[model samples]
Target chain A: MPFVSIRLAGTATKDQKSAIVADVTQSLVTRLGKNPAAVQIVIEEVSPENYGAGGQLLADRDAPKPQEDAHAESSQ
Target chain B: MPFVSIRLAGTATKDQKSAIVADVTQSLVTRLGKNPAAVQIVIEEVSPENYGAGGQLLADRDAPKPQEDAHAESSQ
Candidate 1:
C-alpha cells in the first residue's frame, strides 16, 4: 500500500483540516488512480514557535505564515 | 484550508495508495475534526532511484527499500 505521510506544520482550524483531508484524498484517488477506500492521510499540527522557516521559527518571523501555500495551487 | 502534501518515495501499488488515502482521511476527520470536503491531500510519487536514505539514494541503497515504512504503523 502507498502509505502517504503528511507532516503539516502549524495549527489549522478543525474545519480547515477536514477540508484538506477530504479533497487531498480525492486528488490521490483521481490523479494517482488509487482506490478511494485504501488511501491514508496524516495531518500534524505544529505551533508557530515549533515550526521554523527561512532560518527562524514561524512565531519569531515577522510574518508567521503556515506552509499552506504548498497546496495553494488549486487543482480546481 | 490545510493542504496536506504527501511526498511518497518509490512507486506504490494502486491498491496501496488507495487504502492509505481513505483510511488516513478518516483518521483526520475523526481525530482532528476537519471537514472531509475541505481537506486536500496530495501524493507525489517518486522513483525508488529518486529517493534516498542514510545518505544513499534508494536506487543506490544496498537494500533499495521504499520509504513506506514510515506509515507501517497501522492505526487500525
Candidate 2:
C-alpha cells in the first residue's frame, strides 16, 4: 500500500484536490507498479498563518503584496 | 526549513495533533539542527473509506470487528 500526503496553503478548490488525488495515485501505479486500489492520498490544507516557509509565516509574507501596493500607488 | 507531513486514519484528537507537531519539531531540531520556528508540520486525517492498507480499504477492515463478534457469540 502506498500512501501519499500533500500539504499546501488552503487555496485549492475541490476540483484541484480531485486532480491531485488522481495524479498521485497514477504516479505510484505507473512508477512503482502499485495497485491503484491500494494507493491512498490525503490532502491537507493549512492556513497561511499556520504555514511557514523559509523561516517566514506565509500569512506575514502574503500580507504585504508588492504588486498590489504598486498598483494602488499608480492609481492614486 | 523542514516540512513534515503526516497522513493517518481520521481518529486523532486535537491534543494528539498538537503533540505530534511538537515532537516532530523537536526531532528536527535535535537531529537536523533545524530552527524550531522553521519546522512546519502538517497532519492530514483520512477517512477509513479513503484509506487503504494491505490492498483492503480500512473501512472494510473496520467493519468486521472479530473480537466484538466473538464476544457477542460467547454471550449468546
Candidate 2 error regions (>4 Å)? A1-6, A12-44, A47-76, B65-76
lDDT of 1 by residue, B51-73 (tens): 76667786686563555764565
Query: B1-76 in candidate 2: lDDT tens per residue?
Result: 6777677886676556666666777778889898887787666677999999999999998786689888999999
Candidate 1 lDDT by residue in tens digits, A1-76: 2455555556767777677667766766665676766566676777767766668886787564555764575543
| Model 1 regions lying over 4 Å from their true place | A1-76, B63-76
Worst 10 residues of 1 chain B by lDDT: B67-76
Q: Among all windows of ten consecutive residues in candidate 2 chain B, which has the lowest summed lDDT?
A: B10-19
TM-score for chain A as predicted in candidate 1 = 0.68
For candidate 1, give the lDDT.
0.64
With candidate 1 superimposed using the best TM-score fit, by how many Å does residue B68's alpha carbon deviate from the native?
Answer: 31
Q: After superposition, how far is residue B52 of candidate 2 from its true place, in Å?
A: 0.9
